[model samples]
Target: MQSFRTELENPIVERDIIELEQKIRLFREGKIPDEKFRSLRLARGVYGQRQPGVQMVRIKLPYGKMTLAQWKRISDISDEFSTGNLHLTTRQDIQVHFVSLDRTPELWSQLEQDDITIREACGNTVRNITASDAAGIDPDEPFDVTPYADAAFRYFLRNPICQDMGRKFKMSFSSSDKDTAFAYMHDVGVIPKIQLIDGKEVRGFKVMIAGGLGAQPQLAKVAFEFLPADQLIPYIESVLRVFDRHGERSSRHKARMKFLVQKIGMEAFEELVKEEFTAVKNKVVPIDADAWIATEPSETPGALPAYTIENPQQFEQWKKTNVFEQKQAGFFGAYVRVLLGNISSDISRLLIEKLQPVIADDVRVTVNQGLLLKFIRGEHLAYVYSQLEAVGLAAPGFNSVADITACPGTDTCNLGISSSTGIAVALEQVIQEEYPGLIYNTDIKIKISGCMNSCGQHGMANIGFHGSSMKSKGKVLPALQVLLGGGTMGNGAGRVADKVLKVPSKRGPDVLRSVLNDYATNLQEGELFNDYYDRRGERYFYDLLKPLADLTTLQDEDFIDWGQANDFATAIGVGECAGVVIDLIATLLYEAEEKLLLATESITAGAYADAIYHAYSCFVQSAKALLLDDGVSCNTQISIINDFEKHFEETRRFPVSNFKDMVLEINKQEPSAAFAEQYFQQAKEFYKASQQYRANKTAQTVNA
Candidate 1:
């Protein structure tokens, strides 16, 4: 555990790395609780894998855009610190597994050298900000959304207001009305829009809020048909403020922003957001689109060496499915389908070495676990395809039905129940061999997750499966929970997949064959798969696939899971996807003190709004600690505030008078320097008093 302090240039990032090192030391020494350490490390992108004593380091790439150098840097880091493999995630980040926990700080320092980060890649914070991979190059886009997404990412990264929320927040930018980024499934999804204002064109966004995908998926409500671009960050900030204060806390399942909106109507949520507007740091933070430099090729294009095409038909197919003409004239965008989003470091290095001359410096990792190469010259497509083909990266059907999306599942994730990656590989083989023509079909999407948490985005897939299990005749077997009829409806609208049935994992390929065959047989002219499913109904698909679910037809092979050699058994570890519940009073008090320290730091930095929010968190944390000690369940921060008043303030057990109003003053007044100072003092006084009260009670008990 060597220090990374002197190796980093940026003081802030250096401090962050040093803090991680210190925390890791403390955690190993048993000074910090497991749950608290888990939350801290998760926020820094060090995730606990199913395998003991190793971590998965997720490198956050905002909007999935990375320079060739950054890509190479990650590959090198993978070779040095991980398994020499990189796993691209559905949120547009890259993950490397089997890393030693002690080496994380050094690994993170290396990543930051190229301006890459792992911060907020996991845990209860603002995760990666993803956008349409074709954001800048899409012809259908009203305007390029890359800059706006970048601005949002920068504004929220390490921002105090969202540092510790009830759950993670996701934001996306759809380049066009096609909704390629699936805006309807994000916490704050935006689609670029242009409006004529006073005879001039003005940039804006179609805003959608409170949407999420999991076991209980919800489509976002339209917050605004068109909100001016300048107001985007402020509006999002206000929403986060409201969510942090009033969102569910005790129950991890109900902690998302979508649940908050559901618990309180969207209209009321909007009112809460409005109440936070005054407290937000910026009322109208404008995004400077022109300041964002558009990506271009790093080298001059040289004449391609004459090469013979071994398979002209295959090359033609690749062109049709994987290549598209970009909005930039005479240039194109090509997608390289990375199977299961896993690429070896050797192949990655070769990709950079070979494609550097043919493509732009900007490489965008797609949401479907693939890579998007931008600004390819028309004459270079053949060479690019040849290079990709040489490296075994030339796969057709970039985002088509053949391109299946899946999580690591049992391979690494603690929550994985069955083998998602194995089943995905099997399903993809089935699609490529039997349904070759389906490669051109983009309407049908197939996704898989190890569990129903939707890490693989299975909740909104046209045809989806999540890992499960079934017991038959006293033996347990791996199973797949089938879901259908979910897909994007365009313009911040989508439908959640309906759980159809469950079948043995070995029959996963059969499930795909049956569904596609039925779809092909019963297809009407000019009908989408989902529309046809709706026309036929859920019961129709259930009955059609019902025969496969019959346990009596199962064999010994069905008892084993995919990509496994032995008998199947459920071996789920405690999931760290949302961190863990910390009910320990001492831990809560420590966090309160930490928040107060953060408040002082923010005040010194002249961030009054951030200071006020930190102070507010301190107040809530201290109150919740006392309430939990009194055997009160604090489900939400608002509940904690109200209950504290009921149990302590009214009873004169706590010194604070009108605890609710005292804390509620955060929203009632603007975040001025004076108000921020006053809030910090009040929070400091409350924490100290709470600490003294606890000390006295403990002394009395010990004496007795």
Candidate 2:
């Protein structure tokens, strides 16, 4: 543990690692409550796995971009700490499983050597900021969104505002109107736009807000047709502040930003966001596009690399499906379809070794859990293919019907009910062997999640399935809730897949064969899959595929789940997806004191806006701590403020008369240094008073 302390270059990062190590030690000694410790570790990207006593450390890669050295460093870290297998996620993060909890700070320290991070990759804080893998190189893009995404990632990485929100926040930057990044399903989705103002072409963004995918999927509403690029960060900050203050907290299921927007209409949400503009650190945070340097090919354009095509047909197919012409002429963008997004450390190392010379250093982990290599010279396409093929990284049909996306269901996730990976592998086998030509078909997409949480983005897939279980003749069997008619409509609009039917997990292959065969046999020319499904209607597909759901026709093997050797039984553990909810009064006061410390630190650093927000958090946490001690339920920060007045102030238990007015000043006034200082003092006084009151009550109890 001391090794990482001296090795880390950044003082803040060093302190963070040290804190985590200390927290882990305290947790082992039962000094920190389980729920409180869970929340702290989750924000730092250390997650509890389905298998107890091990962790899954998610490495946050902003927009999935990683340099060659960073990629190699991750592989080395995986070899040393985990199972030597890197699991890429749908959110463009790489996760390594089965790591010892005690060794996580060391693992994170090693990753930081190459400028990599695991911070905020999971939990209630802002997860990894994702963008289209082709963001910079896409021909359809208005401008490169790489810098903007980078800016957002940097601004919010350890920002005080979103540290402990009711639920996690997600943001995405799409490359084009095609919405390759799935902006429509993120909390804050940004699509670049160019508007003419005073005969000048000015950069802007088409902003969407409060969209998310889970059991209940909501498409983000268009907040602005064109907001000046300079105002993007401020707008996002305002939204975060509003959400932190008023978002639902008591119910984990309804704690998402989308739910907050749904509870209070979009118009109201927008008004709240506008009200917080004064409190935002920057009124206009301009993004310098030129600051983000595009990765250039290291090799000078010269003679083509010597390579003999062993099979020209295979090479041609690979080229057609995996290669695309980038906006930069004479350079190609290549995709490598990592089956189930699981690539071994050895293969990853080999991939870097073989492709480093020919390709640019920029490698993007795609949103669909694949890899995108930018700036590949046309002359070296065959050589690139040869190298990838040799390493088993040359699977074709990247982002096509054949390239199925699936999450690790029963494999590692605690919330997993059935085997998403097993079913995905089975379905991919069906596509490759039976519907081989579907690799060229990009209209239809197949995604599967372990549960309805949509980690695999199943809610937006053209053909999606989420893991479930079905009862047949009093026996339980793994099932998949088949969903249909969902696809991106482009330009911040998309459809949520309708729950069509449920069938046995063993019938998953048959389900796909039926759907694809039926579509292929009776398809209209140039008709997309969703359009075809729409024309046929939901009932039509249900009737066509319902035969597989018949319990009477179930075979002996149907009782078993995919990738399992024995009979199926549901085994689920407590999910730490959003971290745990801590209701202990002692923990709340401790956290409130911690918030005051943060507020003081922010004041010292001259970050007035951050200090004010931290102070505001202190006020809320202090109020909530006292309110909970009185058996009052505190769901939202806003509710906590109101409930404190009702329970403590009204009853004359606490002396403060206008607690609401005092705390609401955060949104009422600009975050000036003077105001920040005043707010910090008020918050510190409130926290101290609450502590004394609690101490008096404890003394009275002892006397009684």
Candidate 3:
């Protein structure tokens, strides 16, 4: 570990790893609180798994791009630290399970040798920034969005503004209006656009904000029809500033940015963002598209291997489903459909070693948990196909109905209720064996999650299922909440699937068959799945599949969950998707002091919006601490403000005209230099008074 510390070139990253090591030691020594330690580790990408004493490490891959060397490095790390299996997640990140918590720093240090990162991959920070797998090679793209997505990830990787926010923030970049990256379902979604400005073409983005998916899904609203690409970073920064200050904190369910937009309409959110612009350092930070371009290789393919297809039928099917022609002339893009997003380390190594000659260096991890190999010449397609098939990776379905998306349900997730992976495999088998014709139908997307947090993005699937349970005859059985009529409508628009019915997990295959059979029998020609769903509505499908939901028809096998040996038990562990809450008064005050120091730093940096938000947080933390001392507990930030006004302001214990007005002024005032300084001063004074008041009150109590 010390040797790794010396090898790191970046001083800040070195300090980060060292700090994690120190925190881990403190936590083990019982010096740090469990909740605080959890928060710290989660931010560092060490997640608690269902099994005791093991961690699930999420490796953040910016836009899911990985070179052969980086992939090999991860494979090696997985073999050393975890089971020799790599799991791809819906967020375009890779995860490995059952790792010792103490060894994460060492693993991270090793990954960083290849410029790979795991920081902010989990917890209430900005997760991985994803983009279209076809961003650089998409034919319909106005321009490639890879550099912009890369820039956003780079800017926010260790940025102080979002390090300890109320909840996680998700962002995506779509290559074009087709929205392959599902921009409509992110905190901030951007689609590249070219506008004719004064007889010249100008590159910009169509920006959408505050979209999210969970039990409650909200499609993003358009923030700008065309925001200049140069102003992208500043606009996002201002939005983050507003979210950090005013977003819900105490309630984990409502902590997402979408709820913030819901509480204060989109117009109000926009106004708050406008108020923050004056504080941003660079209003127009231009993006250089050429900074990282996939230029054609100087040394082209030497010779094509003479490969004979073993299964001509399967190879042709593979060509139809998995192969894509890139925007680059004569070059092709190909996909490797990893079943259930699980690839063995040996297979991953084979992909790196065997596919070297035929495939290009540019490899992208697709959102559907598959690998996208770019820049394959037409002549090498057969060779590449043969090599992929040799490695048992040449599955024909790429984002097709046969390719099912699922989370690692009871396999490792703490929050998993039923077997998402097991049911996913069964459903895919049904698609392959029973409804082979639907493989060509890419309109209907099927996604499944272990639980309703939508880690599998079940909320946005045309046909989706999430792990659940039901009671019948005084016995609990694994169940799935069947969702239908949800999918991307393109151009920052989508639908959240309605939970139509619940059935035994074993009946999951029957549900897919019933839905597809109905659609196949009663659909009009050229009509899409969503249109058919809208025409038939939820009740029609409910009636069609209601028989399967009958509890009386349960069999003994239904008691056991998929991929499990024993009868089901609804044992849901605490989900650390949102960082654990910390409410101790001393801890709160310590945090307040730290926040004040951050505020002072932001003010020094001329990041006025950031400074204002930090000051706002400082005030809130101080107020909450004192309020807690007074035995007044509030759930939300806004409620805390109002409660403080009622108890402290009205009682004349706090010297403020109105507490709510003072704290909520973050959204009201422009983030100008003068206002920011004045507001920060008021916050500082308030914090000082709160501390003194608490101290004096404690002294009086002691004296009595």
Candidate 4:
């Protein structure tokens, strides 16, 4: 039998590696002149991701969690070797993408001092052990499951069972019910669940195995609902062992564990896994987790200082869209949106420098495709905001209806189907206009990818589009296949998105416009877009898209009006910074339970008329400003509360009307019926707390 070391000295790691090693050996032996090391390093995938003159080698941190020095060494690596643009990937790993390859061995040697290795970063292996992005932060968590996530990562990091698997594997820790780590799309997903012996909460996790999606998607099956968290490592090891031995080897595409799980029934898979777990359970020591993730992050030095904003209207809007509530008190979390996650060399350097001044000594990269600038001083948030804005990084559209995630396509790779970045921009622009008010008050995530590789995670959005090519006028043109009703993390039960139909790259905006238009026309008074699409079924969307999807022509006039022929920026990671105003409004419209909520109400005949009056007044002031700014002034009836009365004789106690009635019912309805009324209300409360968020932005702008 071949030893594991021998198995690695082969060609799968790219043919060039072997050649380079041979050259180095010959150089050492004086067979080849010793002056060739510099040229050799640059050609071996050792250079930086970008930065023409500077080379930053991306040492992969497979899982996001690392030892204190491994974390600090990365900080040191960047400080010592090259520009410090270290990043955390959506795959739940760290990427120091700009480094000098000539310093490669030195980088590894330094990491080795801290016991870190980057060998499994880019090639085929179980890359990272992902977990809830807020694994320890969400207060509503059933348990802090980071320990298990860390355990799995360490147990599998360099295991022979994981290396050179038939296809890449993704395992996740769903510590909370939210499943935001996207466990449903991973090869294995672990979620904490309490087991009761006598009504006592015993520690265990509900293990789901083999859930994945790409060209083919399958949700994991439950293998165990209550296995002790300590048992996780061995159990997962068992599953991987089975897969490594039994997974399909003949076909690369069918080799994923998801297919293997399907090939064998759930019961059989569990039986096999149990046998494997029992075999290895005694070989390892009980891992001590206290040294890893201890608890939720607390406020620390170097964070944005807090300021008291009296009324941050614009900042309120931005916070409502971008900032998220942390489990911590008197402190909040901000998702530093990195505009398609592209960090320029200058910006990368700026990120490290600017953040170091305000954030705590520790900085964390998030898998949400963003950065987590942790531990801000309660009073300095405004200062950080000001600094970020000064750097041309302020955005009002953080998770707005237009906040989009897209995969890098065509320009960088060969498999991309469409310009996902271009489509994302166009979609955002159109929706922001047509549904301005509706979009402002709620959170909707929209993700896109240039191909079915699922890099932008199109399978997780409320509304998502994947790149596809369709024959147009006898020429294949970039197009998209729309996927609807997909969301995870603290939301609904995960659902595999149903593909509607193909929309040409040019006509993508139109298809999106048609859907939103139908939404505006048909939504059940207060329904969010996903529920509306899910309840209506695919037939409704198909019928609505019929006209636009049919207009695919190679002539280019019928598709995208803003582009210069086949080039659209919708490919993954193409860097879509602006141009969002027009595209979104041009897509889908409402058609059912369809009634636009009166931005202002005219109720005056109620006991709570004072409260109703306050609502009415605020609504009117807000609407007048909103509609006027929206360029909707041409529609006179857009303001139904123009004559709102201070008199208490006509309105009901809950003076709002049901916005979901298709008959346009004026019957008094509670605001509780619309858009997860409770959630929207909660978001409003969060926004209200964003008093500091708004003040900080103002202070930021003033300082700038």
Off by over 4 Å in 1: 2-4, 297-299, 304-308
* Whole-model lDDT values for every prediction: 0.92, 0.91, 0.87, 0.54
Worst-scoring 10-residue span by lDDT in model 2? 1-10
lDDT at residue 271 of model 3 (Cα atoms): 89
What tens-digit string does per-residue lDDT give for candidate 2 at 62-93?
99999989999999999999999999999999
Of the candidates numbered 1 and 4, which has the greater TM-score value? Answer: 1
lDDT per residue as tens, model 4, 1-704: 11111123333342333444555555556654322233234323243232343443545543355533456676677667755555545675555644544455555556555655565553336666676655565677776677777666666654544544445677877757767676667777877777787887677777777888777878777777677766777777777766754565436567778887787777777776665543342334465656764633433554344434443564566566555566667555555666555554455455565556555433444565555555554455665566566565555565556667776444233456667766767876786676666445344667787688677788777678888776654445567888877776342146677788877777777776677677778889788777888789889878878776775335555344233453343333312110111111111011000111211121222212122222322232232232233344311111223312211113432222331221111113222223223323332332233233334545787999
lDDT of 3 at 562: 85
Q: Give per-residue CA lDDT, model 3, range 68-154, as digits (tens).
A: 888999999999999999998888899999998888889998899999989999988999999999888899999999999998998
Relative to the true structure, candidate 2 reaches a TM of 0.98
**Which digits, one per residue and each the tens of the lDDT, describe model 1 over residues 1-704?**
45555477788888898899999999988999998999999999999999999999999999999999999999999999999999999999999999999999999999999999999899999999999999889999999999999999999999988888889999999999999899899999999999999999999999999999988899999999999999999999999989888988888999999999998899899999999887889889887798879886545666766766667888999999999998888889999999999999999999898888888989999999999998888878888888888888888888999999999999999999999999999999998889999889999999999999999989999999999999999989999999999999998889999999999999999999999999889989999999999999999999999999999988999998988999999999998877767799999999999999999999999999989999999998998888888899988888999999999999988788978999999888988999999999999999999999888888898999
lDDT for 327 in candidate 3 is: 90
Predictions ranked by lDDT, top down? Answer: 1, 2, 3, 4
Error of 4 at 628 (Å): 73
Per-model TM against the reference: 0.98, 0.98, 0.93, 0.66
